[model samples]
Target: MKELTPVTIRPPFARYAHGVEIPAHWRIVQTSGQLGIRADDSIPEDAYAQAVICFEALSEILKSAGMTANDVAHISAYVTARDHMAGYMRARDTFMAHATRVPSSTLLIVSGFTRPEFKVEVEVLAAAP
Candidate 1:
């Protein structure tokens, strides 16, 4: 009797992959740390607002890199106000909702930022297929 093959067997398909492997090669792109400066070089006065601004800027950079928030592998957030931690997280969640996968992140509270008017700054690393 001849062996029969399984009719349900199918090859896997990659979709929205975070990375792709090639023969003896890998292309990687690392972006410069982005900040919350508007086209006119204006920054928001509030920390939460500044965080939003930073996220917006980072989003654009990520898009340009052939990725989105879902591709973000890690992130670092700096804040000057410790009491406003809740507000900062709220903003983060809002921004992350647009992503396919929520990336790991770190948050730090500092006494001051480079600009007195700026409240928060965020840096991110992303990879995509």
Candidate 2:
């Protein structure tokens, strides 16, 4: 497998890369929507805490796939309320601080989740060589 490359268009879009080019033979690992629930099935109260937990869960999934946050090519984040957007962004930035390349991302403010307690849910797509 070859290394992944981040694509940047002429006109700047956002902080994240416009797209990622994955080389042939690379394996793609797509994770399910990860919530803030802990191992004991307990969820945090605040949006920030929930966002952190969600990212941690995503990290665990990537690790299981022999990948790291740096291998992530795209990310989709969902929040229950609009007011929680800032906190969610902070948590996401913190979680991705050490990444070599930031992934293309999408953020949405949704009405609710499967569980009422869940304030944040994150899904990630990773490319592994």
Candidate 3:
């Protein structure tokens, strides 16, 4: 994947690329949005913890498809409120910490999720040869 950050436009505000380009021949893996719920059905009260769970689940999904976080091309994330943005970003940063290049990212503020306690949800598109 190629990180697209043209010098003509303003740079990304956070730890991500403005866009990403993947070869047409490369295999791609997309993950559905992951919530914070644990296998035991327990939800953490803090947004950070919740976001961590979301990212972890997404990471595992990528692994299942023979890809890793470094193969990610884009990320889409949602938070229940604006207050959760920081926590969600922190988790995203951690998730891409080892990536060779950061993927393009989009974050949104949503009214809520299926469960009121779900503070964040995340999804990703990844590619590999």
- By lDDT, the best candidate is 3
Candidate 1 displacement at residue 82 in angstroms: 0.9
lDDT of 1: 0.63
Sort by lDDT, best first: what order?
Answer: 3, 2, 1
Comparing candidate 1 with candidate 3, which one achieves the higher TM-score?
Answer: 3
Model 3, TM vs. native: 0.97
| TM-scores of the models, in the order given | 0.70, 0.87, 0.97
lDDT of 2 by residue, 32-104 (tens): 9989889998888999999998889888889988998889888899998998888888988888899887787
lDDT (Cα atoms) of all candidates against the true structure? 0.63, 0.84, 0.92
Pairs of residues clashing in candidate 3: none
Comparing 1 with 2 on lDDT, the higher-scoring candidate is 2
**TM-score: model 2 vs. ground truth:** 0.87
> What does the lDDT read for residue 46 in candidate 1?
64
RMSD of 3: 0.7
Q: Which residue pairs show collisions in model 2? A: none
Error of 3 at 105 (Å): 0.7
Model 1 misplacement above 4 A: 1-29
